[model samples]
Target: MNAKKGNTKLVLLTVAILVLGSVFWVYASFSLLGPKDLGVEYTHEDYVNALEKTGIQIEYEGMTGEELEEYKLNAEKKSIHDYNFEFSDYEQKQFTLTAAESTALLNEIAPGFWWFDDLQVKVLPDGTMEGSSTADIKRLKEDLYSDVADDVPLPLPDSLNIYSKGRVSVVNNQLSGDPENFYLGAVQLPDKYLEEESVNTMEDYFPRIYTVVPGLEITSLTSNSNGEFVFDGVIPQKVSVTKK
Candidate 1:
């Protein structure tokens, strides 16, 4: 009787371990365990096309190695006040950006900042936007801890797969939207966590269009079934980004 009981217990323990392992595997597979493939591919041409639409120019020709790095570092230090905005042939126009273009633009704007990697955005047929990225949790915790109270508990993993889905709107030249779903790895965050004013909108993610294009007025901004973003706006002219 004792021998039979021992065998049964061993079998049960093995089964439990197998079940737990399977569950964790499933969670890791779907969660942000690594970078997600957004299905949109971009090339150098795509990047150039998207950059041109932003009206910013980068001059790094004839410079390589430390020289190029120094130039970019200096540019990073510049504020809006430092740029010279020259306007000509001011007018309102409609612009569109495809998913590939949008992805390229975003990556260019914030490449590897905050330990964010493989960032991508997708627009579904229903105009729902989904964004995903892999983040280094340790770096994020350090950054957050510096600003928050000492007693604030931040139980976080070493890294996380962050995802968000939402609809976006542009009104009065301001881009704003509340994410319907937000996730850390495979776990969906509670609504209360997403309700915080800071994370609720896209305004913090983009610069004021008017600042880049003086006298700019965005009448409408929307996405289409083809996963393209359309913008109707009036601007003094297309502003260019040039190295000074």
Candidate 2:
């Protein structure tokens, strides 16, 4: 009876230790990663910086409904515009122009300018300017191509008897790298056939990974006894995989 009781006590102690450790770990995790998860709030300065780096112009002053819409498109990084803003001086001046009108004027005024390619520009609601033009387009292109040139090999699908599969892991995303780089992935089949495939002839199928944990460097995967494939990776912050 004493031995049984001692064993029970030992098990209970072990369980208690584990529970306490889990609780402490949860608390520590919240303390460390909570701030990162909270999200980064971009300030006006950040908005300006991001826009200018992309070679957009700033027009912070009053604008017509059309001009404002264009600005919204640029500012939101969205092609769709669903709102309007009227210009205060539109009626008083002959230069009453919408965003589209202003763009036309600029285009006529600055045709073949190609200023956008290298400029870091922004336009605020009231027409404030904040941007730098240090973006090196040539260097940027070289870096992008170099990264994509490095490839990953995928085992061909078994049944089709496909010999080999090759792919390029996404090194940069729209939010970080050149937008053109990501856009290249969207080339249509017609356009693809028109242009020569530089890397691999296999139809460039986008890789669809099961997991999307940011900063996770996946190295391997395997199926467990439960019939679920477990992915293994080195997370930027080491996270332990424990059985429940």
The candidate that achieves the highest TM-score relative to the unseen native structure: 1
Query: In candidate 2, what are the lDDT values of residues 137-187, reduced to their tens digit?
Result: 233223223354335243211111001111122323111111111111112
Task: Note the clash tally of each candidate.
Answer: 3, 15
TM-scores of the candidates are 0.60, 0.18
Off by more than 4 A, model 1: 1-3, 19-32, 59-94, 109-115, 136-154, 172-175, 194-221, 231-244
Q: Could you tell me which 10 consecutive residues in candidate 1 have the lowest summed lDDT?
A: 74-83
- Across 1-244, the per-residue lDDT of candidate 1 in tens digits comes to 9999999999999999999998896568443357566687776566667756655433333443355445544343233343444555566667778888877766554232324556787798888988887766555445333444244355666667888889877876777776789777767777776675756443653433234456667888788878887878765533333334
* Candidate 1 to truth, TM: 0.60
Model 2 quality (TM-score): 0.18
Mark the regions of model 2 whose C-alpha exceeds 4 Å error after superposition. 1-20, 23-42, 56-244
lDDT of candidates 1 onward, in order = 0.63, 0.29
Clashing pairs in 1: 56-241, 57-241, 90-236
